[model samples]
Target: MSTTNKLLAGAAILVAAYAGSSWYVGKKAEAEINHQVNEINAAIATQLALSLGEGEIKLNVVDYDRGWFSSKVNYEIRIKSAKDEQFQFLAQDHLRHGPFPFAAIAKGHIAPLLAYSDAKLLPTKETQPLFDAAKGEEPLRAHSFISFGGATKTVIDLAAIDYRDEDGNQVLMAKSEGQVDYVRKGGKEQADFTMTFPSLSLVVDEGDLHVQLNGMRANGSITEQDKAQASEGELHIDQLGINVENSTQIFIENIKTASSYEVKDGLLDSTLTYDFGKILADKQDLGQMQLDVGVKRLDYVMLNQLSQVDDLDSMDEDELLPMIKQILVNKPEVYINNFMLSNPAGSSTLTSDVRFATTALDPVENEELDLGHYVESLNADIRLSRQMIKGYFSGENMISSMADMFFNSAAEEAQEAGLVEYDGNEAKLALSFDAATNKLLLNNKPISVEELVQILFSMQMGGGLF
Candidate 1:
């Protein structure tokens, strides 16, 4: 062969070798990524079993394409971790391909979590099993890309991302060509919510949903079990924002707390403070008022707090029941403020304190006390003017019995004549409470504890009704 031909041949062979090596490197890198993903999937499954409950498991990656040329990667996932469980998320364009600020461009080098769950995407979320968290980037300075970028420079963005693990954990991600908006609408009949924002912002339309917890750590079995033991139904939102009245603009600010909540049988667990802003109904209308609430509990578990009070320790066993019952009736502090209710008799905006506590319950005789769980502070202010009771009570038979007892006692004692006419009439009473105690009120006169109890029972039995 000619020398010139030899040189040309060598160049051709080198080019082919380089192309083959590039292909081989890409294939190997993909295999390694899939292997790591599989490992991550397994860890997710174990946690799902522990957190959600036991169930069948499957993790499927529907599509995975990384375009180093485009500085982008795209993927999709479908997962079913337990019985009757399935969901999918799409993550795209995690890397910003266009020009950005220095910090944004530099942070883009590291991979961001490409997928996160939507509030309503998984209906059985309360029973959804847990998945172990994949390794993540550490916290950095407060910059636009700081939270979701890599530690080094030379960035690549994600085009689409999706993940589904055996533990029922699912995620989705996607990017837009320029800036795109996202809107979510949820609920049936009521049109529960309508929240929208740009492509990068997380949004929920309402219903039992939570979003923006892209960085929360998850562990423990995530298997779905009996509904009884499942976590409360709720939307778990870590960081999110919303926009009302469809428009061309988008805002993803006002991220809420590191909070979680549950709802069951129309009951709510007061775990998160999501409603912090003044809620506007539409163009120019106020819908909800400013409200700040603290320490709310359901089912008034008297036994939990009753055992902690100063006087309950000395109370005898038999005496405890009566005290507990009476305390619940008059002393328990279950309340709602800034609400208005109306009855057939009248209506009023409510403004008052209420209670079922030591000040309202009394013992007819001296007894040992053992109060271990008593609420020390309770107060609420209503935004409305008055509050009311809506239901009615029956007192016919009781009224007659009391009338007869009165006449009988008077005749037997001969302290009064046979009843000619009685002023007794049935009256129902609702109450508003106000007062504070101070053993340290060195100069203030204190109401006797016994007097307070006597007034409560007497008020309920009739003294203050009129």
Candidate 2:
């Protein structure tokens, strides 16, 4: 053969080999992606079954484009209610992914890239008339772009949600952007996230009732599950501002909260601290309030079980009360570090330390459960700042009159019994429960819990007992 013809022949063979290899890789990638998609669909179906009891979820990949180094998928997800098949929620997604990462795919790992998602919730035939009456539309939409990266897998999602009526009148609108991080360590999953919403607004009653939020932001981290079969986390909120105008005008600003929790060896510990920066009523400035609470040795099982109730609205009280009693019997300790309500007018603080134990439950004969037996095991010390009382009474009319009535009825008795101790603007009183006498004590003086409740009720009843 001629030298030129030999060179061309060699080149053609090389090109054919390359094309064959590319085709094989492309086929493998397609199969891998379809397998991963099926796994995800199965997971979604399982969760929906658990949540809706008998609901069904279906996922379909309608379009797919495969490339040597990248791929794209267009898929649809549909969910229908168990009770009413016509009630459905639907979503569509168009995802463009980076290189196939053949090695990861072989090991059953898949990564997602920047993707667009849009969803809608529709009414069923049984509920359509109500929706129509409310001037609602079937094509309400919430759309988002999701991008993921990180050695351990992280996701950054930006979303816009909107709901409108048939007339194209917006009813609700919101926008949020967030980053969520996930990592696995020591056989446990750990996650951290931060999210912010620049604006959220809702209009109802044909614009008669409107609520708007300027901004809201939050951050948190948590262990999904620990060795002791428990989860722990901490969360912080920078601010949540809301303004509402209707029959009454209301506004709130900078509502911040920080909280943490941990569970181990059948015990749960938690703390919550919050501050309401400011609130306005009819454009009147009402100063902020703060609170600090702590719980120790709380029954972890009880809390977890309570949290697992997927539908509380469907739960029967008769079936719930017994569980509550059983949980109380497990005994949990509680502490109140500080609870303060403050304003330009006045401020007060309350603090308490208490532990509960239960040996027996009082019998119930188709009536209310008598919790007196359980009270025998409680020991508590609660203190209230006399300043709070003074502040409440510092105002005229209602509070002052009520204070007068209370002091007239109990002040002398309390003093004679040494149950009342005063230091400047603070009052300290100790509370205990006595099993032998079946009595609840205030500063060593026997006082019925019922009586204390009565006193508080009377104060709020226009300064007189009912």
In model 1, what lDDT does residue 450 have? 46
Q: Which stretches of candidate 1 lie over 4 Å from their true place?
A: 1-10, 35-58, 62-271, 276-284, 287-466
lDDT of each model, Cα atoms only?
0.32, 0.54
Clashing pairs in 2: none
Clashes of 1: 77
Per-residue lDDT of 399 in model 1: 57
Worst 10 residues of 1 by lDDT: 187-196
List TM-score per model, in order.
0.29, 0.58
Clash count of each predicted structure: 77, 0
Candidate 1 lDDT, tens digit per residue, 52-113? 33343444444555433112334345654334466554333332221222224453433332
Q: Cα deviation of 80 in candidate 1 (Å)?
A: 5.3
Looking at candidate 2, the ten consecutive residues that score lowest on lDDT are 143-152
The numbered model that scores best in lDDT is 2
For candidate 2, write residues 398-466 as lDDT tens digits: 876677556444544444345555444444566666565666777677777666565555544534321
Error at 184, model 2, angstroms: 1.4
